[model samples]
Target: MTTRTPAAAVAALTLGLLLSSCALLDGSTGGDPTDAPSAQASERQRPTPPFVRQGRMSIEGGNDVTFELTVTGLEHDGEYLMLEVTHNYLEDLPGSVTGRNPPVRLVDPVSGEVLRFLHDPQSGDEPYGTHFVPGDPAMPTHEGLPTTLRRYFPAPTQDVDYLTLTGAGIGLVPGIPLTRVDAFTPAPEPNAHEYIDPETFAQEPELPDEIWYPDNPPPPGLDTADRRQTMESFVDGPTASTTRAGDQETIALHADEMFAFDDSEPTADAAQTIRAGAQTLRSHIGPRVEEITIVGHTDGVGSDTHNQTLSQERAEAARALLERELDGEFTLTIEGRGSAEPLATEGGPDDEQARARNRRVEFTYQVSPGADGSADTDGLASARRHVAEPAHFFDELEPVTTLIHDDVDLHVYPMVRDGAYAFQMVGLQNSTLSPLEADLDVDASAVPGGPAQYTQGTLGGFRVQEPDTGLIRYVVRIRTGDGEYEDFADRINELATGEQYLALAVFPAPAPDVTEMTLYAGAFGQVDVPVR
Candidate 1:
């Protein structure tokens, strides 16, 4: 599932800072599964409601301040009201709202002066209407936080230019009463959702499962600086509404218009329906959209990957249409699954209606104020200087032999020669004064060999003799072509920190010519030395 967010800009900035401090990659933290609200700012003070003159209305127990307009006696089929609204009433945000191009006029009814609030808060050039959709109760012209109310109105009417409200001031519909639902505070902003202590920005968070694998390296293509943006990503729920129409379950997509698939290319009627659907989405939702992820699903009739691709393509096609027709207000990301994620779990093949429902595009919204702009990051920005990067054995030289040496209780394997080597070994404690010893066997093959041919042999057991004066010498003997003795070396090193394996690699003198070698105990064999 795709995730979208509202304060993604801030979240991204904060996340980037945390990731830069630690090192991680950019990707989603999984959507909706973690929908905790932000805890960045201090508690918002109880808001003061806007005043209206027509009738008496109060925002009951709800914390959100509501502006109620009683339409009991107004001599008309509908009504409208105008007022200056700002989202962040507690703070004065300059340029937070703009009317620059296509210059807008916010005519204040009382003062006759243009009052500009943050962003454009109009559904259309109106008397914002109060017409109710069928089955819906005769409700207010608007309901919800100022942002939600402005997002969708029943219908814009001629009686009002526009009904404006701040995030704190919500315009009420005619009959439905306003209520401040709860008093819960949002959680603090996380430094990194799955990577660091969400509260204490400096600490690391519980890591995800993928990081534990030795073979899994951090993805290289992503900009580490941008990883924080992933924290702000989230899913905002399904976009299409499902309901029963006639004998079938129908899903009405919220967009400019609605369209039914009949045959080749969308009909004008279908196009119009899509247009209306899109319009509905716009009127009820602003386009501060970061990414519009569309996932198209299908009935299970093909391979999982194929179905998945189909579903994704369906979503992509819908997104393409939306972007092309809607002035490119959204960045569309599309995906298709032929038949994998199904909405109806118990329906039979006879249920074409249910199958059709399953084969649909699911829309999710991701929001961010600075999605396209440079958001001020939360912490000090710094650069990381890597001491080294991994090099490959094939790139430097080819391995003539691949060896697998597993002795009782110990196992080691070499995949590439003359590169990095790794193995596991455990020492045996002997009762005799002499220490036990073992040799590493090798298997070689290839072409060229005379002595010059690739030869494999064993080394080590360089003689782990009796201890002397509390000091011990562990020797490593090398072997070359045709079981010939090579060179021998010894290390009177410290008793390893503990029983473990070690891995390292060294370039031999050449084919059949044994050069230097190393033997390590414990799991430490993965050591790679820089070849200068």
Candidate 2:
């Protein structure tokens, strides 16, 4: 992942001037030094900047959502004017639009000039400017909190005295004076970075007869909808609707069919059953199956922990058996969900019949749409260590950001791999009466030219974060953000309140050098989270 180009790795900060010549991550050109002070002057006045703000204001989204956007002060960061904002969301239940980068415009108080946010119009709105926010769409409102955000606008000239804000839905905020220049937080210099080149395939590389993409090529909607429809089909019988070959196909198997009562090991006759399942996979997947995911489940018969492990073990056993039939030449993933997810939700815990029904494994196979005898069969490297939850991640969990309003604490424990720097994001003690949700992907902006993550758009979004020197690189391999691990998305989406679950979210990996990266956590300002 560190194979950055000479142009990508050039550190703009080392050049001394804030507006030094360098390629911005958003695929935009940079370096109009005329707006910035000389390097010597910028370094001299880097600290103890003056404060310049009058107060805050409120704006209603017409119905329901309201924002408490305050102009805390102003800072001159080279050519950009950093407007410090204290955004307090008022009068809403949990899951409001707190963690989002809504569009903002600036109206020059005197000249009546409207300054739209200066950014790559093609890029997703998040972590505005050079900051990366997982390149996801703006997250829906979460329980509103008191937090400060910095919006960088092209600095108003010395002639312009004040500027008012025009926000989407939130409407216009009061005016803020623009006096001092070049005394705000300077944008971090981008390090020599490494990433994929879109133009490399620019002539619109033929879309494979089918996209050999993730479960959700662009997002979860289609895949989830398919799953929902598949479940519906299951009610009618185990019939697959889309079996054009090389597309996605799913098969369901009851636990009783593969294992004896209370056992993880496959039964003797299970070999034939698994072989049949594998044949079904091979026939429907056609020439090459790019990926196979086996999800195991159990009824609410045992403790959650025990049930989860049992389910996992069963899934693993099933995988091993399938591999024997396939000669270990296919992509496979095994997951277990003890009683945490029962197929028979309405069934009581002690119901043996329902538990038996809940005990099962699901096999989902995806084949590269245009696969031939000579196609690339490499699938995403399956997690060597499967975790039932984020707590099992190989990193220490620590609170990274604490927001206002809701009793939610954002914690991140960094996980740096050889190719990327990923973090395990967690939201704790969401005391709302409903489940609280937080999408780090939706909340954070992806860095320009950042490594591709699972959450990236079809056009792709960069999620790399280079701090200080350009030596370390943080690349994101999109996390599911389904709250299976990070719980924030789960709780919030589920609207589960008054719960204290240590929900963890594991972001993709980053380069090893980035032991720590600075993130502007809500309300806390800039906080450095160490990638442990």
Candidate 3:
């Protein structure tokens, strides 16, 4: 039940973009439960379909598309019905097809109860074949090729044999056909099928349940950013607590919390405390925060020269620690106030407790009014300041594949990152005055056939196979733009006129022994892109 989608579909989904929804298919409720699709009575009680040569059924689909439904395997061992389905799409996509939900469901023709996949999509427990397992299909060879996926439903008794496939924006065809089926070998038992608990499978666990209350800040194996959970500094500290001042938040860290007597270096205990303070700071400041001002102070007991030096060093130390702990996207400014400002007290400079309290560090952060990087960005404004270079610089990139489609020219540059294939989609030009719309999607599945449904397939998609071994180099992410990671994993619906954008698609790095690979791009066809 891994939410299978067309390789092109994930861009909209993974990026959280809301597109138009397709209308749901309607089905009637009353029908005989025991009737079989075939006239033979003996075949009704059989565990699988009788072997029929060329056993494939084609349905004329909406949007000028033809759906070829063929069964590769089927079996019902009491508890659950296991079925394999492959749908081959023929003809071109209709103009009306935009970013829309193509949700599909398995329906009981007789009972009218909508059935779900055996495993939950959110469970992250996908069958091995789910992503192009030899027989399992999530791979596509061409737009017109059949891609397969497996499905599970309440087992149909001897009386029940036929099922229905329903989808949004598509009409339901009763008594859908299944292809070549024989008695299942080593039939599976009811207990063998995985059952989903609604409560447990409702959503993916953000953190492992076993380490919900880890003894340390970060549970082992968690990402670095998640490790911030380990920060205990902000939780319980008299010297440091989050206090809101006007519109800004302040992490008020008392001197005693960070440093020991007469020391500019962070104390052994203060190291952990500072780490906690840094994590707390991130929660308050956020990644969008641009500036962090760290100011340090000292008591009146030290000479003005010594206090100034100590305050400067302490402020610098605190700034370094915070920068390392935070997202490191801010401009940090460290300053030394020395003994200029002490805690207000009746004894003033003479009070011993006040003197100790005077030595402290304060952190403040600020953000620009236009930090969201929307369509209109000042960064873009600044980019306009530089002289525009000629377009030929891209041609200098060696071994590029240039192809023209719908009057637009596309340049593909294959590169490597961390030993993985990271190809660039560059030089996308409209080459027309009236304006044009083009799909710039990429493939995510490694299989030759698409997922059971057509959603996971990519029309103009590509994959890499080791030339010597023919092993697939699966894709992981697709980003658009030239700036190192400017559009990392971003899905821009369509490229319009005058829109000059580049994309970078990443795959698992091939081994050093892999010197060459066969790059397969759906319509663009296969090409040999060298491995570095």
Best by lDDT: 3
Q: Tell me the TM-score of each prediction against the true structure.
A: 0.23, 0.26, 0.25
- Candidate 3 lDDT tens digits, 1-532: 3222334221221100111122111122222212335435423433332211111111112122333444446555545555554544444433223333223344333222334344323324332123322222222112354444445444433234454433322223234333323433332222111221222222232322111100001112322221011100011124453322112444546677778777878877666766665544444455556788888988787699999999999999888877776657678899998888764232533366556556778776642321211222221111111111001101123335766666565654544322112322333445666445545334332232221111122322445666654444433321112311111222222334443333333343444444566766544456677543
Tally clashes: model 3.
Answer: 18
Greater TM-score among 2 and 3 belongs to 2
True-vs-predicted CA distance for residue 186, candidate 2, Å: 54
- Candidate 2 residue 48 C-alpha distance from true site, Å: 76
Quote the lDDT for 404 in model 1. 31
Better of 1 and 2 by TM-score: 2
In candidate 1 the C-alpha lDDT for residue 184 amounts to 15
Model 1 spans with C-alpha error above 4 angstroms: 1-269, 346-350, 366-532
How high is the lDDT of residue 522 in model 1? 23
Task: State model 3's lDDT.
Answer: 0.39
Model 1 Cα lDDT, one tens digit per residue, 364-455: 55322212111112210010001111111111122222223333122222211111111111221112333233234221111111111112
Q: Which ten residues in a row are the worst by lDDT in model 1?
A: 227-236
Instruction: Please give, for residues 1-532, the per-residue lDDT of candidate 2 as tens digits.
Output: 2122222221111101111111101110112112236644532322221221111111112112333444556655445565655444354522212222223445442222334333333344222333212343322121243433444555544354444443322222322445575455443343211122322212122222211100100111112211111100011012111111113444557678778887998888788767766655554465544678888888776688888898899999989898998776678889897776654433433355456656777787664333221111121111111111011101122344554434454433332221111323333334555444533333244322121222233112212233653222221211123321111011222212433222222233323334676543323234566654
